[model samples]
Target: MNLQKFSLEQLASFVQGKAVGQTEMQLDGLASLTQADAHKLAFVNADKYLDQANQSKAGALIVTEELRAHITSQQNFIVVENPYLAFAILTHVFEKKHTAQGIEATAQIHASAIISDTAYIGHYAVIGEHCVVGDETVIQSHCHIDDGVEIGKQCFIDSHVVLTGHCKLGNRVRIHANTVIGGEGFGFAPYKGKWHRIAQLGSVLIGNDVRIGSNCSIDRGALDDTIIEDGVILDNLVQIAHNVKVGANTAMAAKCGVAGSTTIGKNCIFAGAVGVVGHINIADNVTVTGMSMVTKSISEAGSYSSGTPMLESLHWKRAAVRFKQLADAPLTQMLKRLDHMQAQIESLESTFKLRK
Candidate 1:
């Protein structure tokens, strides 16, 4: 927790933001507004948290341009285009550097594997035959990298992760603990009333700058490689099925599952617990809200949501009953009969007006 201190002006310059109020104010660490003291920095990105910002005892704050006018506090602050993004960048600057360096003697590395001198292989990590691990890549303890797996420079494969089936990783990719990449997919064939297991013959191709969270399971393709393009982010416990091609810069939140052969477009954002059906094409820049089930393809880029809104149990049951009955009701014929009665009433009203 002994982070290097940075003055308000220096941090603002580093993040390419504008510093306002006390430029000489020093901040040693970051904290939330409610938890911050006088020496800590905090940020307010939305209006809902503005009240807490005003009451915070922190020495400095990061704020967006839209939120700048709302601050009445005397605390030193920096106004940026996006305060949250600036905060995220600063978190990297304040992160502690890994102390582990070089390969441990207990690691099992095959003679055919090509590992760089700068890479750190932890104790008990197994590197299989013909594997290529690039410079400065960290293969943490208990990680099992299978035969012919290629990992590019500066990638971090955390502990207990299994990279099998000749998967490929591009530069600076980060895979968290307990994740399994290029595992056998859910493929099967039916013959004579029994299921036959289909061999997953493909691999997984992960692009640069992708960060996958802990406990994720990414299945290998049945024939073609499953592709996860550059800058794609996957949260914890996400399930990516076989042959699914996740486009560049797309982000998926926790517990989201994509079925096999789905082609998700670039820059799309899927919120928590979103499920996408197989073989569907999602257009670029689409945003799926939390807990929505996408059963079909999306051709247009926009925010989409499904699932009924929460209601009381009694009211929900009543609505559900009526909804089920709608299929059997002749709604079109009922509307036509109502229209005819309305026309007759209008004619009678016209005659009464004429007699009057």
Candidate 2:
């Protein structure tokens, strides 16, 4: 018998679902429709996957009400308004729980730092001066919490992560490994043919429930604080530069780079490798397609894309020439040419009418 097995009623309550037919059936874990066994639970979020659900040998399924009728065979499933969301919620139930309490020996803690008794500081993790670590927060192995930093309750800072320059994080924040918050921004001024470095004076302020992925960099601001609002999720290898204010609940995919001083609005989705230029504003509810470049401000909420699609080598070479042609013709020149063509068409129409 699987140690992690869950009864149908027990799993239904976790997602506020209605269990049907097999209330006594036990599911050991969650799996995809194509791979689930009789002891595993599966989900069908749409009608297209109904065939997969029908053939699956799973003990039960999680599905929406509308798709239930599409199954050819009798199925014991949990009915929910959103099967995908229920799947996401149930994933935590099967996740491996790591429980740790009390600071480990060989960890360095400054006397001025205030750490809650319930917090866990793992082996060799460094807690710097005047830092406040809240209750039930876990600072894993070799992590560094520098001077004047504050992390709120239930926050998890993973191994080898760095929180420096007095940065402050709100409750329930999760910072993955190899991530560096409050690093210096790329700020330099040209003086006598040499670049003079400008010190980053402000730290980063991350709000509650923010999840930062591994190997990501969130830079400190040049003068004002870099603000990441509540519920923003950044994928791995993403870069947030100086003085940027990322609005609430925005999701940035991997390799997306936002330049300095730009303000991103709430609920915007940046697909993978999308590059946003500095000093521009992106409106709320905007979705930029993958590999697109955002150079101007987005005022209206809509989907936007840039760059040409992939082509064969020779065809791309010809397309590149056409792009160069448009680039050589400035916007003002194009507008003037359009006006001239319109006048010529009107003149030709007038001449034809007189001749007729």
Computed on alpha carbons, the lDDT of every model, listed in order, comes to 0.93, 0.93
- Give per-model TM-scores: 0.89, 0.93
C-alpha RMSD by candidate, in order = 4.8, 3.0
Clashes of each: 0, 0
In candidate 2, the residue pairs with backbone N, CA or C atoms under 3 Å apart (3 or more residues apart, or in different chains) clash, namely none
Instruction: Give candidate 2's TM-score.
Output: 0.93
lDDT of 1 by residue, 1-356 (tens): 46598889988987899999889878888899999998888889899998998889888899987787888874478889888898998887777767676889999999999999899999899999999999899999999999999999999999999999899999999999999999999999999999999999999999999999999999999999999999999999999999999999999999999999999999999999999999999999999999999999999999999998899999999999888877655876788899999999999999999999
Against the correct fold, how does model 1 do in TM-score?
A: 0.89
Error of 2 at 314 (Å): 2.7
